[model samples]
Target: MFCHSMTNSMGEIMKKDKLVFKSVLLTSASFAGYNIGSGFATGVEALQFFAAWGGKFAFSGIFLALLTSMAVLIAIYVIGFEQRFVKSSDVYHYFCGKYFGIVLDYYIYVSMIFVTFTMMSGAGATISQHSGLPAFAGASIMGILCFVTAHLGLERLRKALSYLCICTVLFVLFCGGYAFLTSGVSPIAGSANSEHYVSMGLMLRANTFGIQNPYLSGLSSAGLLIVSGFAWASATGSLCNSKREAVFSGIFSSLFFYMTTAVVVYLVLTSMDHVAGTEVPMLAVVHFLLPKLSVIYSIIIILAIYSTISGRLFLIAKRYDRGNKAMGFVIILSITILAIVGASLISFSKISNVVFSIMGAVGIIVCIIVLTRFIIAETMPKQLL
Candidate 1:
């Protein structure tokens, strides 16, 4: 009874001291920045895992969004609450052991480093894919730009880049809404097949390779969404530095994301009569809906890729030695080299699945560890694990 009363009192205090609206908005924007990347804006990812290869598995995306929002909300709330006790540096330590925490921290550092390189490569690829620049050349220039901008630190980078991603997403949503209003909606031709595939449990783990078993697929999907949320929440917490701020930001940003993606799904699904594959569905939709706006979208794609690269670079800088001159040189040099190699070996169309697969597994374990700690802290005594 005492514990229950204490729990209730804590909840009331938390609710009363909830994240302010302004802080929440900032947090959500940061989270949005993390969530909207190459695979997100292009719809290639949606097509591969959720739409085409998944065989009209439309509901999977919805499920993904739902699960992602829930996990993120929890993560953000925990991070926000923990701000009094733990800074961003100790978030991992609180989740896992000191050894495990260090491992996870370094893993996060490595992941951010790689993610920075990949984003730079992706920027160049987007330019090559859209403009006439060679992918290699594009990668080099992008890597340079990212390294320069990342030096400015998180405050400046987030202020500048968040708008870029947010604007592009808003544009896409506005266009999608317009398209839907004008053309009207229609069901997928093989909706039954997609539904059946989902029902049969293939859609959850529908890979480029083949259908995974029901159990594995379900778990994989669950894992991906959860990690996405955790990663997003960590980024959010870093931005807001409070639990209430993270929660509110997560809630608003997630709503915006869902609405935006829902519009994309509608636009892409409706335009299938005119466009088939998922690879360039956005381009197709743009070409079909407003031919004159092609250049605008091309720019948007390039900027979206840029925002991601810059954000990742800043993340890497923060994780590594923020003040060390040698670390900056290393980050720049390493990322540039990796970008060149990445450009040579991988195309967004080719390597997204593999990257997500490896990252997804690691992300899930991290998220679970963090979430378990949060739950225990909230519910149990410190004496218990």
Candidate 2:
């Protein structure tokens, strides 16, 4: 009898552990998918923020920046779990006061729409570059797809994002790792061609919002991530079964996010000669390394773009839909139409460079507020929220 009872207890414990592990992975993948938009998928964001600094600064700078971003993400998750927020935007109100939080909320709301536009542009750029299809065709396809997935609601969206995130990360790691290993040029070694070396000053000027200082750049990047991803992160946190799950998800997701970034940065640095002046640097590198995979890589980029836009559009539609199915459909359709039109007109690089910088600057302010709140919460004897 005693032996049988012990066996039952052990089995239960194992089952519980398995469930927690599964939950952590799903949460981590969903969070990663939410953040991996066009800029990240194409390596443009990494190139501008990290690799552009040359091999020496790229690793250290990206690590620091991603660390800061990771901390911010963890804090948001913890707070979200504790509060159990109904509306995701309320996270801004919690970090900032009611008035300022309201302002930031609206700002982020509009910014999310703009980010969707950027994703549309990225989709168009990826397709046009790869297959010579009209940019609008790609944009329209992405917009429609995102709308459909998002309309499926949160439960379905979460599962879809998780699976897509896994596939995308695996693809990136394989390509980046393969490129770095196969490329004869060492990443740390400065480029032999002085003409190809992009000076820090020139890179800073060309990037517009690019911060030459690694620390500041990291903060800005963290800020941008926190601001743009606040809704999804907070929502994901609320779904956690316990604080342990939230923390685990945050740590795993953060490490995975930065690890993939480091690989891409290394790949870009080694292949700077080939990727320079290209709109999609990662695609260019993949083409140079494995020409056969370029077309497949293009589809992967679109899938990544789809994952991100679905989350953004879901949040936007949910906020305005207010439980009305017809209203939600109309909202998604209108946004898709507007995004497709905007993407058709604007260049992907311009939107990524100029608009993202401005958003990152705004995001910095939000990050400060979140950090301050987190510090205070930790110091207090009682839970503030």
Candidate 3:
């Protein structure tokens, strides 16, 4: 009872303390920044994921995703609290078991290479469209930034990402508010719904676009959140002052994220038909709303992409280094070469779609393990094993 009381007190303290608010905001922003990468900022990601599903599915899918996510996120946060996993490898080891954990650690190293590819692709797309530069120029610039930021160490990286994420959100809010004010069409216009609840085919084919397994949208999306949020939770949860603070941060940050996403979705839905066809959906909408300032919007897209690239590269360097300066430099150099190659090969959307789908399955498995462990720990009276 006393423990429960303390938990309640921690929750209240989180509300009253300005420092706690900053910590929670920072932690949440870090996680959000990591998860909201190139595809997300461009808005093509939402066009494919949420807007594809129409009004009702988008509505229900997002709600279910958040509901299921809170439980899984809290479970993951609790494990991180107990284990204090300071390394990316330690995070995989804890959730994936001993043998599989080793495999996953290697898998993540390989997988991050592909994500690095997508970032390069995004940077190329942005500069090519906005400044008429060669695609390689943008990719090279992003690679250099990521290379530099990786060496800044995690503490500085977190501070940097928090500021970038705050800017991204503020910019998004401004764009969303502007779009909403000027939007003549309603959000559900051309949606798969007359009204979301009254829409037919609630299960399969629920999406406005013809993306497959519309029924799995909620689960797959929830899985994506877990997979993307996993690295941050395991790698950074210890930043919170206590388990209570960690949980508080996780819950509220998620709320902040989905709330922001809801705005983006509304904006996308209002301009659904047009944004759906573009390579950079957010830029497309901004161009439509405020064409005179498209140059500034492009810069924001590049910054958003750069933020994720830097954070991912930092984690990869730390993975190899365990904080050794020489080894971290070597890993960063090798990854930079591979990312340059990735830019020459494919477009951003193609790479992001493939990477997100592959990682979604892995995220689901991690969430299941955490949920099972939470259940078992609850059933046992004496201890958490």
Candidate 4:
């Protein structure tokens, strides 16, 4: 009887641990979802940053960009824990000082709204591609959903995105991986062949210096990474009970994001020809792999849209008059309307060129501030650390 009691007690402890483990994964998955939204999920990010370079060179450029971005994410997440920050502005103030911090605080609204807009546009593009729906119809549907979801409050926000993130990550990995391995199309196959076979370092430099605005793509890639991950990851970090948990969650989140990107990149390269010029590239790849599941594929992308909008709205809400639900609703509605207008005005690829590239510039500014703080902290006395 005592042995039976002992076994039951052990089972309870294991069950508790399993709950914690699942909790961590769900939170991390939410962070990963932020990165895998319309931009990464739809293939616009890959097309502009990596696919434009043609074949494997695009992958190389993305590697260089992601390498720097990864460092920025890790630093920001760890510092977020150390500072015990509750908002993105707090971290900005720590690294950027007072005036700049306030400047960034305002910019956060603009930058995030812009990102939110792009997500709306991406959802539109994906749905239109999936069926014959108009882009306006698709964006409006997404905008309505996001606006409503914003009203459900934070705990529900967390739960909704957590489940959505799980679905997104699974589809991207399994579907994307399978598509890449079996797809017959490859953009690299038909490249000029002049620079097709270049070395990784040279390939990156060739693309970096090879383009009209050489710094645009690389800088934007890093910049978007900053916008997407830091605030969400930091919030996730601050929720943990201990420093170790915070750091582990942040790293795990980043790992999953990179893994999704790698799979999308591979799938894009394999079907680079079909997707390169298209608005919703990943959807194109999906259609090729599972033609009948187009609607299902689109639904998954829409689910991802919810996660992105929710995370962005969460950050935006904290900046307003202390969780003012009304103000948050106004802000979300206003942005969603604007996003619908902008999304309807152009092709997904054109928006990528204009909007995201600019965001990339913002990212560079953010990276400088974070790195400066990191440098000073490391050089300072032990007390600061």
In order, candidate lDDTs are 0.60, 0.80, 0.71, 0.69
Off by over 4 Å in 4: 1-23, 86-88, 184-219, 382-385
TM-scores, each model vs. reference: 0.79, 0.93, 0.86, 0.83
By lDDT rank, best first, the candidates go: 2, 3, 4, 1
Q: Model 1, range 26-95, lDDT digits (tens) per residue? A: 5566556665666557655454444543324555555564565556466645665555333344766767
Residues 1-385 of candidate 2: C-alpha lDDT, one tens digit per residue: 9999999999999998899999989988887788778978888777777777677767886777677777787888888898998876688888887999889888988989999999999999999988889899999999989988887777777888888888888988898778667776887663333135454222321132454465566566666677778888888899989988887877777776777778777877787777777778789888988999998889889999999999988899888888898998899899999999999999887778776777777787777788889888878877544
Q: How many backbone clashes does candidate 4 have?
A: 2
lDDT of 4 by residue, 201-300 (tens): 1222112223433345655677777866667766665656555555566566666766667677677666644554467877887877777876787888
> Which residue pairs in model 2 clash with each other?
none
Q: Candidate 3, residues 1-385: lDDT per residue as tens digits?
A: 9999999999887776877778878888877777666766777556555766676566666676677777777777766776787566777776667898888788766666777788788888778867778778888988887787777777787888888888888888998888777776767674534234223312122221224554455556667677666666666677777777678766865776676777776776676555554557677777777888788888878888888888888777877786678888898889987897788578766666777666655656666877886677657885545
In order, what is each prediction's RMSD in angstroms?
A: 6.9, 2.4, 5.7, 4.9
- Model 3: lDDT equals 0.71
Which of 2 and 4 is ahead in TM-score? 2
lDDT of 1: 0.60
10 residues in a row with least lDDT, candidate 2:
199-208
Output candidate 4 Cα RMSD. Answer: 4.9
